[model samples]
Target: MSRVRVHNFAVSIDGFATGEGQSLDAPFGHAGTRLHEWFFGTRTFQQQVLGKPDGSTGADDAIARTWNDGIGAEIMGRNKFGPQRGPWEDHDWNGWWGPNPPFHTPAFILTHHPRPSVEMEGGTTFHFIDATPQEALRQAREAAGDLDVRIGGGPTTVRAFLAEDLVDHLHIVVVPIVLGRGERLWDGLEGLDQRFQVESVTTPSGVTHMTYTRP
Candidate 1:
């Protein structure tokens, strides 16, 4: 059976996935890109995100490379799509990832205000929907077909899916930083770890990688 998954999701030591006051100017907010420094250093990130050739190799790169494995569709919060709140002012704002997004599949955006689907280059189609988590999963599952659906999150989205117990595979990278105030991944999620078999390992980059998968 196909699965709903979260991959390479970063969080701070204080359990913050992103800092407060997220904006178009500051996507990661006060925490900045400090949360993703380990990712940027990986060869997989250099190739996939930066479209570059040279980067470090090791456990981090290996984990980064798996972000796209067997994933046919992506579901993300409106916050992950952009920093905009309320109704969107700019209809032309495709996303933070330029024209050719990495997903290369149907990427579902969960929002209260829905919009017409935007088709982008490299086989990525942005479909906006206002539905409950279960409803959204149904759409994503159909779009995914034989492959798995990835929950590409900004904390809130992941929390919602996790709350509904829809996620089957979760990969969280814990950065060794302390963001005193930010959106937390563990809020209202007590005993969430019990749902999956978790395996943790500290990488050479001073970050711990945790993978939670159901048996």
Candidate 2:
């Protein structure tokens, strides 16, 4: 059976996944690149994001490597794709990942206003849909076939799927920081830890890698 997973998502100590004022200028809002400092030095990110062959390897790299392993499809919120809002003011937004995206699978973008699918250089084809988290996951699962479906998110999207109890495995990296005001991940998720077997490990970089696996 294919599982729904969340990998390598980072959140601040204050529980904010993303800060206030998300726009083209600041994709991560005021939080900036602080949340992703750990991933930036990983071999997986170096190869995928920077198109480099060399990077740090170890516990962090091990976690990063899981990103593309068994994931056949991905579902993300509109904000994850870009900062454009309200019916996609311009149709030219090809996501923050440039021409060739890292996701080499059918990526479902959840938005209120749907648009035609956009095929990038790589195998990543963005499919925009206005549907419930369940509906979107259904399409992603169909595309994934025997492989797992990854929930690529911006907090809100991940929380939606979590609320629906649709996620099987969740890997979150808690970065030590305090984003006073922003979108929080643990909100409205009271006693969510009971649903999964949780394990936490502190990496050399001080980022705590927490994995939640549903039994």
Go through the candidates in order and give each one's C-alpha lDDT.
0.93, 0.93
Candidate 1 scores a C-alpha RMSD against the true structure in Å of 0.8
Residue lDDT tens for model 1, 53-120: 98998999998889899998999999999988898786988999998888899999999989899999
In the range 74-112, model 2's lDDT, one tens digit per residue, is 999999999888877778988999999999899999999
Model 1 — TM-score against the truth?
A: 0.98
| lDDT, residue 39, model 1 | 88
| Model 1 lDDT, full chain set | 0.93
Segments in model 1 whose C-alpha atoms lie over 4 Å from true places: none
| Residue 144 displacement (Å), model 2 | 0.8
TM-score of each: 0.98, 0.98
- lDDT score for candidate 2 against the true structure: 0.93
Q: In candidate 2, list every pair of residues with a backbone clash.
A: none
The C-alpha RMSD in Å for every predicted model, in order, reads 0.8, 0.7
